[model samples]
Target: MKQWPFYCEQECEQYNVSSIYAPYLFDTSLLFFKAVSTALDLYGGNMSFYDIVTNGTLIAQCSVGELTGATDIKCCRHQMFVYNKTPVMGRTHDCYYNIGKKEMAYIRQLRMIDHENVNKLVGFCMDGPVLLSLWRYCSRGCLIEILTNDNLNINIDGFFIYSLIKDTVEGLYAIHRSPIEIHGNLSSKNCLVDERWQVKLSDYGFPFLKAYEQPKSSSEQLWTAPELLREPEAHPTKASDIYSLSIVMADLVNKNLSFENSDYNGGADEIIYLLKSKTSRLIRPVLEPVIEDFNIGFTHLIKDMWAEEPEQRPKIDVVRKIVKEMNVGKSKNLMDHMYSLLEDYAASLEQDIQGRTKELVEEKKKADILLSRLLPKAIAEKLKSGQQIQPEHFDLVTIFFSDVVSFTVLASKCSALQVINLMNGLYTIFDSVIDEHDVYKVETIGDAYLCVSGLPERNGNMHVKEIALMSLELLKKIPDFRIDHLPNEKIRIRIGMHTGSCVAGVVGLTMPRYCLFGDTVNTASRMESNGKPSHIHMSADANKLLTEKVGGFVTKSRGEVIIKGKGVMETYWLLGKQGEALLNVDE
Candidate 1:
């Protein structure tokens, strides 16, 4: 691009010597690239489009990168700077540049000077020996100042001295009507009210005064008009200046200056600036007059102003006309005018109702997503619909239970988020295996998961073999879990399965759940709790069913064992894939 001096000289030629001046302040000690780089990294990118001039030489510049590289861009600087030959405490916090341009200087300047129609012009440093002008700072901060200030508790009056508003408009008119439009970086900082309630526009940092051709590639083009945003960009034209002013008008009408906190903006460059430009002028009139001294309406106006399309906006003169006509002075009269002006209030109210309804639908979708994460979608949906899913009593359901070994202790080793991801990962493996077989998942209680086949509806003789195969697959897949948060723990699942008569039905009124009863469920849970990791335990009936017909598993009879409340029962361990060397079934 074109160098600084060439551009400056060109600007001087076009706007006369009064609008342009060459830098004379010089001190190499004060001119360090570190300070400039800090500023660039902080505010440099799109918002940092301005140049850092110190002394008689240009030290460095900050420019936002292209869109593709935006996310990787970290625009923060922590370099130190020397002001008044003394070290300033922190690096220049620059990210607030674009939207907070005027406010940065205005805030400090307001405290230093009391001025009407002139935002407090505090001193600014050029990252070198020389100092430049900065807009003033106000003691009470900006409009949001009193709103959020805990100690002050000052109630904001919307009237804000109409004369002050008029003066701010006059200053705006002067800036826009100038030979070259002066785009006041009109942030809350740049807007100030002296003790006398006089309003002034401060901080001319981003304004293009007089006329000068832009660089072959202009960095500011991102927020500029599309024609100016192209390569070999057009000069910063009057229309662009008007576009920026529209944003300033919007700030006044909306009360608050920044749109950063708004969720609607979504980081779209052209759209953000455009929305800021439209403000109160575009607000549905039916809703406007009813807005009391202070309410969410001001925030709503800010959103409408900065809408994506600039052409859909009203002109400044037209905006001025609306504001003037709506100056009904009295609150009751304003409310009366609200009914007759613009569209009907009922329609706007209906729109709000529709918007809320849409939001509720989205919330339900998200809740369903979260629920699906916790339980299988089929079961989760059935539960949500409030269906009485009665438990199935069957003579042949294959019940399976698996528990994460020492899950409670492992949970203590990790963060809440880490534990959740780890748990989900383990369950996901089990879920995948279950889906391959003819089985339906019951529910997960803590770290334990339950599943059944052969009722609700039965898949016949395959239920026992299917559950056994699923358990084997689960054991084979166990070691894949490697959670950084729990390095010492290897995720191991202990499984237990049973095949016999059991009554299954939905239980409870408030938290209605489908569960199995009788010895089958109790035996299955006992098998998991008592079994070793990577091993599957089965009741005598389950073993007999699998070994007699399937004939693949190596079964080891563990003799009669006492099961809670059911007395001594015979059980066997299926030790390996079927037909491999048996694990001494009688031993």
Candidate 2:
């Protein structure tokens, strides 16, 4: 036997255990254990060793560990541990190594046993006296843990339970049909649950290894066939496996350990004695009352599986067919059931999300309307879309300024409430007229109203036309706006407009205002202050724009008047449309 340098006596002395032996590495060509990198003391004083080895044709590494722990899963003499290996790039075939003449025979046979309900054997480690077999890791642990756990809270229906039985039967059938021929040791503890909740059979075809393990107790021999119990040296046959499956099925249906509900007064020792003596009647787990409510045919089938005569037991293939028949109209497969549950949950979540989305849209609509009232529609839309409203420069725009002719005199004639009522009525009329044009109302200070056109959206020279038409309409409507307290007293307003470049943008955070900046706004205000009652005053620029660009309006020059800002500036009095009079009195 050839040994690797990793097993040198000097390095092996580091662990303080016995030096590496010679026969442990016999058959140099069949050697699987290369080197031990780390060791873990698993439950029950079992040792788990890790090593890196070549996988397939690639340069990748694999983890090989021994199964040692009290809680570790056991199937006969073979203890199982997790075997994870990363495939090397460009590798076509899987990597493998021989353990020994006896173990390699079982390994070769196990390699041919490929089924969804069977755990795959990746590799094995036989370094020194340690014998470790590597199998795929089942994340959900063993079926014994699931059946015994009280806090797991697994919600299983009758059909779902039957599905598990059917999977077990199928797994057994695969083993029986393979070269392995029969599972010498079949029990609930050997059944593992994968991440998909599918049951897989583990720990089979290793009788040589089982010889080194501890002998099974009478309690653990509950699944052993009557003939096997009588002859302790006899190997498990197909009939004994069938009898064992019946006990496992009973555990599934009863949700308890095998023979837990037996009527025998004595313990498992007494029960084993009776079965072996052949003097007492054959004893099995008593079927619970709930089993009667389940398929009566299923209960009868279980009885046939554990029949006193080994020849009377059904074959693995027949058991699978019977279980399939029992699942005709039962629940779907485990994966399908899980997907159905998730789909239903997702549908309910989608409905809740849609309801919340509808409420959000309605609230957003209300907020949009409120914002539009404070700022221009375009600017409000930009703000809602998370865009910064940069101040815009308009080369040509029309600004309109208006106020009551004598708001103080009108207020002095009425009480404060009457004055408020009058102002509300008057502005309401003007606001309606303002809406008839494209001009946006900028602000309202007491009796003064400010508006602008050609921004935040531009309409070129059309701003002059829009503002001029709106001013004429306002002048035409003011006489009809009588105070509620003094109905007989007619009201009049002074209106002014100017056309020039100005900067407009939203200002402030609390209550933002769409403010207009530049001398054009001030000149427009001056025109409104220096105007006559029931008249529309216009700056020279506005008058020129109204005459040349928008010709439908009638305007007469007010001549050069001494303005506060300028020495003498020419202005105009805006009349009305082409043929209409400036004052349209409602008699």
Best-fitting candidate, scored by lDDT: 2
Candidate 1 Cα outliers beyond 4 Å, as residue runs: 1-362, 366-392, 405-425, 455-457, 485-489, 548-564, 576-587
Model 2 alpha-carbon miss at residue 254, Å: 14
Superposing every Cα of model 1 onto the true structure, what RMSD results?
22.1
Per-residue lDDT of model 1, residues 1-587, tens digit only: 14443333334332112221121112222334454665656656644335543422334432222322111122322222344654221222232223256545443433444434555434544463222333443323343442334553222345542333455555555555543244424434445543333556654433222122123122122224333334243354434434444444444444443333334433445343443355554311122222256434334433444444546544445544544544555443322333333245466668989999999999999999977654446666888897656555687778999988888888887888887898888888888888798777888888999998776666777888888878777777887767776676798777888888788666766665666788778888887776776667788889988989767777788788877776788888877785554332334
Q: Given candidate 1, what's the lDDT at residue 509? A: 67
How much lDDT does candidate 1 score?
0.55
**lDDT scores in order:** 0.55, 0.74
| Lowest lDDT block of 10, candidate 2 | 86-95
lDDT of 2 by residue, 19-124 (tens): 2232233322223432222212121145323222322221112224354332223322333232244311110112233457876777788877899998776665
Residue pairs with colliding backbones in model 2 are 43-69, 43-70, 44-70, 46-68
The TM-scores, one per candidate, come to: 0.37, 0.45
